[model samples]
Target: MSESSQSRPVKVTVTGAAGNIAYSLLWRIASGDVFGKDVPVELALLEIPAATRAAEGVAMELGDSAFPLLCGITVTDSADTAFDGANAAFLVGAKPRGKGMERADLLAENGRIFGPQGKAIGEHAASDIKVVVVGNPANTNALIAAHHAQDVPAERFTALMRLDHNRALSQLAQKLDCQVGDLSRVAVWGNHSATQFPDLTFAEVAGSPVDVDQSWYTDEFIPRVAKRGAEIIDVRGSSSAASAASAAVDHMRDWVQGSDGWATAAVVSDGSYGVDEGLIAGFPTIARDGRYEIVQGLELSDFQRQRIEASVAELRAEREAVGDLLG
Candidate 1:
């Protein structure tokens, strides 16, 4: 905490501090892209025991940057240590699906990682702690974390669907020849995987509805945004790094500071739009006063309903696979 600042420094903990995404993400939070330029941040970075040295090196770089808003840094291998007294947390580390690995295996492995971390968060984090899970299969990972964190409100936990949301915006912008800012009510629904539906039903540019061919929306836009991560991996030879980091920043920033228009995020479903209760599913929401209220009563076309149902089915399957790990 700095006396010159308006408030105490936000203790923001980030997992996987040694990874590429964290490398980009740390700078954003430290330099105040997340909580605003005036708000100070005390960063607590978490890594596995084997990556401790590498995390320390990253900390050294942060020191060199001399970001004015970064008041303190703590690099540790202990989740308890990383989350203790934290105000916000980014759960970004998970086992990547290796070649020939089954989906069930991946879910079980990530369950083990998030389960204990969630317990630690419940035990050690601040009462108002907000968590965003950013690893692969983020929605399920978030569900496991939230289920284990019995004391924390389930609404406080979310997964990063902002990447999908942003990807949809960019793809639409390119097609419509409009700035991304011109598009409003653009949303991504369902899983963050290829099954996600990039809804153009309500998209508008300059306050006018986007009038594009239905074939382009289905054949080109949907798959493009849904498969963008794999496309990035194919070209860049790495999973999305900077873009994923940027989306994480956007998700947390909007959640903390609020947003003016609709923002898409994967939150615990309250049976909205027929999504099963207790499942973490993507939805369009309004964030205000540090809370997200799911947009209600939008009439879905039959096609939209079917698409969302398929994605939610995937989420339900994931939950079932990791049922034993849920606390």
Candidate 2:
């Protein structure tokens, strides 16, 4: 009934010890982001040996904070050990886009890492374990990990869609001149890549339909959110790490903590909207009972359907590319 009861001691595992996002996320989890005031929790941090000290730095911070609900912390290089008994595992480490590498090359590099981690999770993680991929090329990387984790249900795996979902919420708020909390029903469709589509057709800004122009949709809004990652990279000289971390926390918080009145789009296994069964696809979703179910039977306008399909096409192409690489 409570967060700890629903998952228990909530053995949370975070990959990438030296990474910026994981650093941001670890302390917050230790401080009891989801477990509430009375619940207890333990943390298992996974890092490469090179970054174990940094992880320890974070562990030291946790101890210094002296959060009452924080029971214990463990840092390790072994995925098997880090994931053991973990109720939730966050895959946050991945190779980023280098100067000369293509997208396929990046996906291939991540596949090599996530595949074994997936198997480790399947073999050792707790029975109700849930995974979220926060690294780049998240959707396909999640597929790779899920495919390798043969023992786990495909639906148990998910990639972070909170960034896009938040972008849409923010945009709707701007359009309607209202607060983000009042906006609901926004959806992001298809891949998490540059091709993913944000659908505002059913979303309400301040409880009213968002009136946006198609020209602005094509010229301004869609491109803005889709390319926001790149813009962040240009300005910050690093890929989006902080906001990505925040989105990851928001995602797990919403998933384990419950959204109540709010629902956001998340990329889960495609069981809704006619997407192929195993591919990671985005849809309007709410997290409850340790699982996310895609909101079904929403009315779609002609324009929205076309845009969603376009994004799905891109996802299918990536799937094919990865499948070939696996072969």
Candidate 3:
């Protein structure tokens, strides 16, 4: 749309296009909110066969919205078709935990979904394709996908921890009686689950070190951020949609463009802070040249170390449960 357009349209494939999160995310991306106005994007909407028709309806709405940078749209039930030539992908479709379902059951169900999709991405997507897993059990789902997508660099596969990162920021902002923009360097470590640790050890507000009460940080702030999704579902009668979509956009945008400061993402660990190597765990990260690098060498207090270790153990157990699926 702009005269100074620098490159061809990025082909982005989004699974679960018929769902609420995708519903919110598609509009943001199509409107050039993620990739900027000067860059164009073509969307490949992937849905299950039962949901393909709904995905088509969503495409029709996109057409009606008249997004200037949306060059194309394709709705498909096939993962191979969806990932074809894709430069970016958001794996948002996974089996949700139904009544009476155990955690292992959820992991195996999602592994079945992501493994095939990952293989499809490996065979079909562009060489530089980057992927984000937005579905529940996201960290392990990403690990499964990365294992199957052997051709794609494992580091390119990340889970959506930015949502937790943002939750931590918002909670801390409220506690400090300051705007969210006034905060910097807040990092979420470990799984994007109840075990997550939203560390403010190095956080700053208005260029000053954060000095919140220790009991508040331990008793209120950490659990609040870690379990925010469950809290949202409890209060709203449904899981988060728009906020999750926004965080996905934030994570992908930072990965594609760059981060202004430290952002939290669930990237494959290189054993930083004693997280298991290859575990997709949340860490303080910076993006540059379209790659996320974990911010290393930060001192961890004993409490923080224990919090992180507990989450990593959960991640290890998950990997074991899906051992049959991984290569």
Candidate 4:
């Protein structure tokens, strides 16, 4: 280990640690790809009791990798144990939406799970622990968690919309035949589901403002990015794990290390862009010194306003469905 690695280690807790997304995420974090290579990390991995054995297997693999920055690892079935003194957390475990189930069903089911986890975090985690909810119905699930975790600052909890944001960038880059890094300021608004608006109105490509074909933007681009998960499932026989994990890393890393440009995340809104106050919604954001702030002063077009309203409505409905969990 280097001298830097000998410094105080940051503790990171990941729920659903044996699941596919966590499987992809743990290795990157252990290798210091999320936090700086110089910053040592101790991983606290959590899963249900049933998955404890699988989590042990994952720990074995992590041990085999011999990550120089990884100082320690703990696998647990208890949230309180997993979150104890955690500096950061990834809430990647939730009951997935099964076939023929409605979105409300998923939200209610996850509410039961996140509510307890949130209470545990509030009671056991570090006061500054930053959380990212990566499971499906993530925005509302994050809201439930934050609501229950009253001791933790509500802003510290956010949902994973970086996946949608990255999807938008990739789709635009493919159309323009440019690298994904050449794009900036792309934002995904409102919910993480089909109602999301992947707006390019504020985006720039290759340092020039993007002026895309309206027909393509409406017909091809928006749907492609919004439903990319379904598209992947159709082609790959499974829902996205790798891409989702990569986006989670991007979200947490940029959040802690500072973003190079505007990134999108689903954060608790204080009525920005007319989103309901206290709602967790996606917005164009920037991170600095380990905090995320929604980008301010950007004027939205009428088209953007209408699309955003539609999505916010969906979020409001979700909040209503899980109203009891909020308390």
Cα misplacement distance, residue 248 of candidate 1 (Å): 0.7
Cα displacement (angstroms), candidate 2, residue 320, comes to 1.8
Candidate 1 residues 160-278, lDDT tens each?
Answer: 99999999899888988889999898888888888888898988898998899989989988998999999999998988989999999999999988999888999989999989998
TM per candidate: 0.98, 0.93, 0.98, 0.97
Tens digits of per-residue lDDT, candidate 2, 1-327, equal 454484557788999966888878877777777545455788888888988998899888878989877888998999999989988888998888888998888888888889989999999998888889988788888988988886899888889888888887777678767888888777788888778787777767666777788788777878788888888879989877777777888888777767765455445555566677777877778777766778877777777778878877877777787885445
101: Cα error in model 2, Å: 0.6
lDDT of 3 by residue, 77-195 (tens): 99999999998999998899999999999999999999999999999999989999999899999999999886799998999999999999999999899999999999999998899
Better of 2 and 4 by TM-score: 4
**Candidate 4 lDDT, 1-327, residue by residue in tens:** 246534979899999999999999999998888888888999999999999999999999999999999989999999889999998999999998888999888889999899999999999998779999998799999999999986788999999999999999999999999999999989999999999999999889988999889999999999999999999999999999999999999999999889879999999998999999999999999999888899999999999999999999999999999998875
- Where does candidate 4 stray beyond 4 Å? 1-6
lDDT of 3: 0.94
Measure candidate 3: CA RMSD.
1.6
Ranking by lDDT: 3, 4, 1, 2
Candidate 1 wrongly placed segments (more than 4 Å): 1-5
Collision pairs in model 3: none
What are the lDDT figures for the candidates, one per model?
Answer: 0.91, 0.80, 0.94, 0.93
Candidate 1 lDDT at 168 equals: 89
